[model samples]
Target: MSGRQLYFKCECLQKGGAFKFRGACNAVFSLNDEDASKGVVTHSSGNHAAALALAAKLRGIPSYIVIPKNAPTCKIENVKRYGGQIVWSEASVQSREEVANKVWQETGAIFIHPYNDGRILSGQGTISLEILEQVPHIDTLVVPISGGGLISGIALAAKSINPAIRIFAAEPKGANDAALSKAAGRIIRLPETDTIADGLRAFLGDFTWPVVRDLVEDIITVEDSEIIKATKLCFEILKVVVEPSGAIGLAAVLSDTFQKNPSWKECNHIGIVISGGNVDLAVLWDSLKKGK
Candidate 1:
């Protein structure tokens, strides 16, 4: 009765068009009625901001989102459509954080950190919890690492439920700060990051680093090209439209990064967290045509 025979947990169908909703909902629901009514603020390039916006809306609370000026227009629109108040900042990551902080100071809004808060982590952890229940026995779990909140939560939940379940964090090679930090045994900040996977662009947050370092088994890097290919493959094979960052986990597995392990062949029960499906249609079409 090995875990490999169990079914896979397809979280791509989660609310808000990504698995992020789990954590967002969890964090928002955990807030006391008073704090929740005070409203919330967060900074995100895309998916997380939308998740928070939707979650806050569900809670009958207002949300302020700080997004980089150059963030995908689709993501910005999603945030606004979900009832979030958007504050635009310089396209750079630093400015987004600064703007979010400024909003917090001015509004005195409760800051619902995108990845660093314990409540957020616990919320993200629920993805793994559901996966385990759905699949029953999962041998390997693949997750994309951005600010490390998602992977950190999944790793903790998966490991606690079954320590034998190996957890790997997939990241874009261009944005490999998490991998470098893991190797260095400390948090490493990238001076500059240039990756089409906007969701994975940020450096790991302080709260997320420790959980990832201690709980995660390994961090693997994938090229941007591979991510593109994987994204297209998901559209073709799974009939799911995944953003570049969301497809990293599947890209790593399909690219043979973990194929060398004999255990993988014997126990083919690999659970990939297909995190989001928020790609811009125009960008997707252009990338496909260019790749072809």
Candidate 2:
């Protein structure tokens, strides 16, 4: 355990069991009546798909979800339960965008970029406001980075409120595009990603990259093994069900990269964003069986 006062901002217990619902709802409800009539469309691996589907359902509009063939079963089921029209795609960003484009063209639906839109970023930023209010004295936040929406939004809002507050991005080493981008001082896209934390596979988008570059304190990369260990700790010790991506913030906090950092010595009151809880039981059982 980290020798710090770790305050958990549990977005895992959100409406769609992930912080994604905040952005999806904002994007869906922000649409005008005419645009809403055409419905909404997007591509996602899992959490965002379910979030958008549920948001559209609440707004009485259809949601077209282009999902990769290899998305977690539990997430796919969530989309189905929320009445989304599923469009299957190959497990690649290009394939997902192509399929989503086709749907958008055919249906004339408003396209919602999962983590790249300003509306979505503002919605996710609400987390920072809530966190600061809930833990007034906290000076740092450890957030999991995927497409960069969550952390970008957080860094923007948190820094606006408390300029001295630190915002660290938590990333899986396998999908370390953001880390690479931060280091190279430019956006870096990975041709392929290989990470057990499916939700963290995405790279930063144009809108998110600028905020991350300027406001984020640093990137803490953790191994998949470390993520699994954090997931196990959440289940056994914290009694919280967290997906691997959601637990990556905790993983990063416990990682040697963070522990060994002399600059972070004064960051004693830390806040960790538990981003989601939509775990695949099969994956969970398998990891437990392997005792990782």
Candidate 3:
């Protein structure tokens, strides 16, 4: 974990504009013929819904997505563009889940959970598999944690590949349940969420908690300003339009939060997972020039 080379994985370049595709595709593929034919339903702030919609489209199955009323308009449009039906709920993750469950009860649609299913984890694991293949010896990996699906999947795969690799989860201070949960040694729910990183606001699932608890090395929380700064940096330095949640790993690195630990800097290479790229260009441009 210390004095090892680190490399970064830019999964923002992943298909469907985010790393969610890997999990969505895997979950859909894991379904039996009857299940797939019956279609799938899930709730999401944005990225996961789009990924699942696209995945269902690819599989020739229908997808029903429950989205919050205040979800980014662009994401809602993407879901429709990808041939998914949208069920709108109050502007909250809890409302979205309730709506999704209602849809499931009525339609018998297989619930393709946004971040809580074992098959989703297996699919998300493929991201680590790809990263390992791309970089031979990654000593430390920093991944954004939202409900712990992506990080849990990545940790499981990365640890299996090299037990010595250190896996860290980067979270926004506004949605710091994972950080708190890790400290409490149990799943802890957020009383209220107010982060710009909409995709990272959900609480960790029961299935995901166990995987993350046993496998992840640590959770690092960053401020909203830092997330904005990192998002701008990615656009300016890396020429990528990364969402706030997606840029958190970069934020952890750029803000020197990780570097605070002497041992962390000792690692020559650090791998950060740029999880998504579904930002509204106009909004991102405004954010980029805000303090300039």
Candidate 2: tens digits of C-alpha lDDT, residues 19-109: 9999999999999999999999999999999999999999999999999999999999999999999999999999999999999999999
lDDT of 3 by residue, 1-292 (tens): 2234535567777777888899999999889999888899999988899999999999999999988888877788889889999988897767887899999899889998888998889888998888889886677788999888999899999999999988888988998999999999999998898777878888899999998899888888888888998887777878877888888888877656677777676555678898998877776667666732
- Between 2 and 3, whose lDDT is larger? 2
Clashing pairs in 1: 3-137
Off by over 4 Å in 3: 1-6
Best by lDDT: 2
Could you tell which candidate, 2 or 3, scores higher by TM-score?
Answer: 2
Candidate 1 ranges beyond 4 A from true positions: 1-8, 261-267
- Name the lDDT of candidate 1: 0.83
Compared with the true structure, all predictions reach lDDT values of 0.83, 0.94, 0.85
Looking at model 3, the pairs that clash are 5-269, 6-269, 6-270, 7-271
lDDT tens digits, residue span 1-292, model 1? 2333333345567777787788889889998999888789998887889999999999999999998888887888889889999988897777887998999898878998888888888888998888889887678888899888898898888889998888888998898999999999999999888777878987898999998898887887888888888888788877877887888887788666666666456546878888887878898788767762
Clashing pairs in 2: none
